[model samples]
Target: MTNEKVDVVIVGAGASGSVYASVLAKAGKKVVLLESGPDWQLTDLISSEIWGRRVKPAGAPILLEGKNPMAYAAQGGWGVGGAALHYYANFPRLLPTDFRMKSEHGRGHDWPIAYEDVAPFYDKVAREIGVSGDARAEEKWRPAGEAYPMPPMKTFRNGNIWLKAFEASGIPMVPAPVGMNSVEFKGRPACLYDGWCHVGCPIGALANPQVTYLGEARKAGAEVRAWSTVTRVLTNPAGTRVTGVEYYDDKHQKQTQEASVVLLAAWSAQNPRLLLNSATDKHPKGLGNASGLVGHFMMSHHVASTWAMFDEDVQNHMGTIAVQYMSYERYPKKSHDGAFGSSFVTAGFAVKTTDLANSRADLYGPELADYMKRAARNLAGIKTFGEEQPNVENRVELASEKDEFGMPLGRLIHSFDSDAVALWNANFEEGLNVARASGAKEAWSARGTMPTSHLLGGTIMGTSAANSVVNSYGQSHELPNLWVAGPGIFPTEGASNPTFTIFALSQRGAERMASQWGTLTN
Candidate 1:
């Protein structure tokens, strides 16, 4: 056991974990962030898509057994910067109505707080991270928040091709908000516009955790130890507070780190898995499983691409691959009765052979050769992001199998409900219509719906302790000193990339924890 104690110990040096470390450490707390992957840094981020796969998490494999199994290996982060190291940095905020779904639509669970409550944090993170976009262009669907810090990213010829389709179809399109810099800000360089971002950005232009909070945390004197896998959350005899955690160091030796406060930001699935695996005599279900909802409500969005083949070269390989144009203004809520979620349409995607969305892995021989030849210079792509409703049946449980550390493996089970399928169908049709209207010589979509890496729910936050593991601030209802950070606390995730929201919530929770340290620790 390590006798030295700290004020805060955070598990997972990923996006939200690094945010808390940065904020609380800056506020003078003794903080330590434990990461289970390699000690990666900015220089380690190579420009090759194959090399970028190094950043994806690979500590322990969870037994995925769902009709819609999430692609965790591709979406999760393994090292210092975490998943942000290779992300496109699509930084759109959640819609306002997303917070009050049950109240307005009588579908999905309502968030404990509203969009207004998180708006300030959104602005704070945006300014700090230097987001780029035109707020007025997104005014129709954008929630109330301060304007982006930088000008929108440069649009390409592919955007022009998609813009006509949106216009002709009477759908609205706006410049997509992105975390990559449009201009030099806060000492970071500007983007190179090489469209090679699918792998990772070696330059500091993209606001990955290495260039953002994780960097700030290092400057603020927060200690981060890589290959430190936390296995259990140690608690007091009364099970009312957490003392710290037990983890395996790089040597695979069991060690203990003592702290007054412990926070778990180890992704959506692992957060609940850690809680459940920590089951003890005092709490057999788990540290935060008294409510029996810690592992329930696991959800992931369905992302489908609609690619168009143009007669003339649209320069699809030109600019940012995340998306050049965005559309959300044409979503008809009344038209789709069974579908009950937001639809986020993004245009301008470059074909990356590593990505399943672009590669037809099932095709071979002449068909494969022909498809590759046509896709080389003629393909322009758009994607439809449909939010999945929270279902209790989709959950994470402790599998009978154990890892090298003797800890039970996490069993992830998820399936698309009727409503989710409806939402996907509706969103897919909407995307196909826009593509056909664009005067493309050919238009086609991915063979089937693809599960997004954007995982949510599982150990959700709510007003009551009976149904939720944490509160709006990510404070545990069962153990005050043990909180679950990250997207796992989300009651409902809107059809938007969650990295920005993760940063905002981490900022909010960390700021509050710093301000109310005396009360929180007591």
Candidate 2:
């Protein structure tokens, strides 16, 4: 085995890891970012949907199928850019009430930090990442912050239809702020409105990691090693601090890297998995499981959606990946039932030819061609993505089976709570009503098994070590030098895409780590 040393070691070069690396490197820290996936760039993203399916990690086969069925339908980008490469650039902030869930509605745990505490960080992140929207329109519930960097993307025909329905229903339909560029900013070109963002943005108009933080971090002298699968965090005989990580390189050879501090920035599932796998005589349950809560409190956004076929050509397919909509009215506090409110967006962009085929197949294949022919005439679909209360039962644990690498794989155990189900039902009924109001021949509600891109809550944070795995600053209570930077540190899953919050927390953690680097020792 080969060994090397660095000031800081970060695992997983996804959204949070990339941001952490950028901030630390800019602060003049020597950093090494290890990614299990290969390094990929915008130029590597092919424009075709078929090519997109072939874009999984070089050697990590899709682990969601067969005997080791995934606990949830998890989908994320694999590579140095991580899942941000395939993320739809919806950059909405969690409402103020989302922070104090337990105090406000008597549900789930509250965040250790409030909206006010994180608001400045949010504003800074938004400006740095270049969000585009009218902040004034979202002022009702969105936490106070600086205005968006650019004007909202132009409303397409389908967006206009949703706006009309929203107005008629007394539900606000303000522009949804997005990460897609509306105008040239920070040297990146404006969005082409091509509707292929879910696959990946090849033109750098969207703020994926490759086009934003990772690209900047590389230029700032951070070293990113892809295809480096970390197996365990090595520590001194005392087990009081992390010394380095033992990993399997691309060639399946073992190696170790020494570091003064270690940051676990992997996604929700993998973050807890790694911690659980790092057990020793001192931490038999897990590295930081003194409270026995390393992989508990798993949460995912509850999703509900409805599609309508309209007589008018609503341009069913065209425009940016995300088109338009509103979410302020759905703030959790407004419902008064202690249930989280629902957020809706109009999927007005053109459905790719492949999506059209798949949607037809999903509805039954006999009328497939006819459905495609009438797709343009139908125009719009409303999708509601909401927050779920954190339930300890819904968790990530290790199964008896092992992965191809002979390491125990993650077993996800999750289910929606009564509150989540109530919100989902209400949103579904509301969406159907809106579709009917929009002059639809038929309105169909879809509630497929709730899968989400916004993964949150596992190695949660709290004011005290007894209540959470990590402290407010993301430093583990049991292991001082081992920190976490990702959505996995969230105590609550607010109804917003997690990228912005992830960036903010990572910046905060990196700042804290950089200032206290001298105190942390291997």
Candidate 3:
């Protein structure tokens, strides 16, 4: 087996890991980033959904089970940029109440840290990432923070129609906080508004990891080794400190890279999967699984769609995808009324004829073409996002089967609580009302689908080792030298998208690591 060493060895080159690598390397630390996928360049990205599929995780097969199986392929990525390459960049911060869910609403579990603890990092990350938004427009309920780096993106006809409907319905809608550049900043060009975000941003207008922190990390002397699939985190005999990580290199050969500190910023699934698979006699469950909670508390957002056919052509495909506008009329804990969790609605996108045809299933050649023509000119869609409460029963487990690499595969099982279901129903109805209020001849609700990208919990952070795998700083309670970054440390799923919070926490975690480096290594 090949052997190498570094001061810090990071697994995954996604949004969180890239940020940590950038920070640590800039601090003059010897850093090595191991990514399971191939290294991607900005030029490699294209504006085709089919091509975008190639970027998703292909390291191993994962078994998904539950009423709503995790949309693994759509939610994960394999290249150096990780899943952020295909993200829509809807960057909304977590509400203050989101952190104290259990204490404030007596519903979900509480986070070990509070919103104030992470707000500065939020500001720092937003400025670094070049967010475009109007804090004042986000309404009086928005948590305090610096104004967005750039003004909000110009709203198109779709947003105008959506705003009118929201006003008619007495729902508050605001310019979406997006990570795409409204005006050129940091040498990256302004967005073309080509409306291909789901397919990945071909240009550098969007702040995907490849164009942002990965480049910063490289400039700071961090080395990124792509096509390295880490199978386990090795530890010392006492199992109280991380020794290194074991992985399969590009040639499918076994390799070991020793490090003083090991950071796992792989997404929620793989982070816990690697941790659980690293079990040893000293730590019988897993490296950081002393509480037997390595792969528990899985959470995902509930999403439903409402579509309407307007008399006028809306050109819904003209602007950014999933980054136009958002309505937070129902996003606060105190405003829930009878609904159990926070929820919000965002403007949706134009549809392809084939997709609409598939949805219509019964139509033939002529009828399908006719409906497609009408939908192409007149259709408008909106999607609702609702928070999920953490449940122990919703988890990721090791499957009986093994992958081609001979590692135990991940099995995801999740089910929404009754309250979550109620919240989704309420949001779905509201979506219909918003559409109808927009003066649609017809409006209908589509069954809610779970977003694979926003998955949280599993290896959650908490107050102590008795009930948590990591502390608030993402430090393992069992292994001091091991740290977990990203949404995996989240205690509960907040209603807003998790990308901004992930960046903020990663920044905080990186600073914490840099501050403790001398003492920990010595």
Candidate 4:
């Protein structure tokens, strides 16, 4: 059934959509954000790992088929706040080189805009939401920007173990730039450091959208329609512009939201899935697939995780469940002889049901129990992140299988190229060395490629429709009224987590969208 038309209908209430909802509403545009999951309020954020799974995608899972399948459900969000509700709040910025990957290295795709274009929004958003970091100490890794509003976040007991190794390896590390408060800012409390970040942070210190942008959106008169699953982006007869969207209500009834502007702001897979599923007689391939590249070039960071055991109690469970120390010595895309991409250091991972059991794949009976007993006090680990090249063959396509709503499920096909493999291998060996240098009585790592989450590509933003679905500002090239956002628009997957960049890009586009209200609606 048709609903009353509004100025804008944004799909997804996650990181990117929340930013748009917040800014556009403040700019006086009538905004409605549709989420496919329940309306998760702060009180709904339970502090239990098992209950925390509720925040993950509860509907149909993305069908994965590739050399290394992604951990989509583990990383994706289902409810109101989206994945931001359960993310660890690790807020590292994309290196300036990230934007110009192809321009500088003759590999990957160059962003239509540069890091400079995103810097202002990054600075503004970080301050507004409360980011804690030591930019000066991050050295050449961090680009020019205002210092973080808060200082570095809390450190765990295992931090010393990794710090010593970092020093010895000549890859000195500093406190990570994090979204959780180092001290109270914007009235949000400091992190409890209980390491319950895997579950949702109920105290409102972690900068999840519920505690930040969505709150702003509500105060600014934006309406968040939770349990509204957007299935297709409706286009005008000529497919020149998007008229609105078609979705399923919580009761599984069909509903339509007509808006002057329609945005596919969900994460990578869902955005392209919606678009490809919305094909019309005028645009047979997809609404934004005039170039036939709507869901191509899907990318995920190449990651490898390593763990170790210190002689005595290291108390690895006491701090933020995020990467505690940061180093970018290997951050240059071609820093090494054989490696073709950049890699970074992520150490002192929170030990929750961890030193992580992946290393002991063979042990289960008493061996696993004994390891856990020691891990309670003396376990620590390190993980290394490397950029994954955006290969055309790695992509998301509509699978033959359909969900309960009769929508074609998205099937992903992805594999690391030789360049990404070389990069991951070089850094993975060093990660093992770093663990050994920590004076660990025992050190080991999980075999195979680690399950990754910070996803990118699929509906990449570029210079034109011939090569990309959206432009520099995330405006769709084929349909100007149709916009896309989040990590899905990234041309390259830099090693750092994507939430920080997602906010910055959405903020940048939101301002432009607000400024062009007359041009768009008219």
Best by TM-score: 4
- lDDT for each of the candidates? 0.83, 0.76, 0.83, 0.85
lDDT of 1 by residue, 427-519 (tens): 778778888998888877675545665889998999988878899999998788887888898998878888889899999999988888997
Cα lDDT tens digits, model 3, 224-306, are: 99988899999988776889999989998989999999999888988988988888999888878879888899998888667
TM-scores for all candidates: the values are 0.97, 0.94, 0.96, 0.98
Segments of candidate 4 deviating more than 4 angstroms: none
Model 4 is weakest, by summed lDDT over 10 consecutive residues, at: 350-359
The clash numbers for all candidates, in the given order, read 0, 5, 0, 0
- Give the candidates in order of TM-score, highest first: 4, 1, 3, 2
Candidate number with greatest lDDT: 4
Ten contiguous residues with the weakest lDDT in model 2 = 65-74
Q: Model 1 scores what on Cα lDDT? A: 0.83
Local accuracy of candidate 4 as per-residue lDDT tens digits, 428-511? 788888888889998876666556657789999989988888998899987888999899999987888888999999999999
TM-score of 1: 0.97
Per-residue lDDT value at 350 in model 4: 67
lDDT of 2: 0.76
The parts of candidate 3 lying over 4 Å away from their true place are 334-338, 348-366, 448-453
Tell me how far the alpha carbon of residue 349 in candidate 3 is from the true structure, in angstroms, after superposition: 4.4
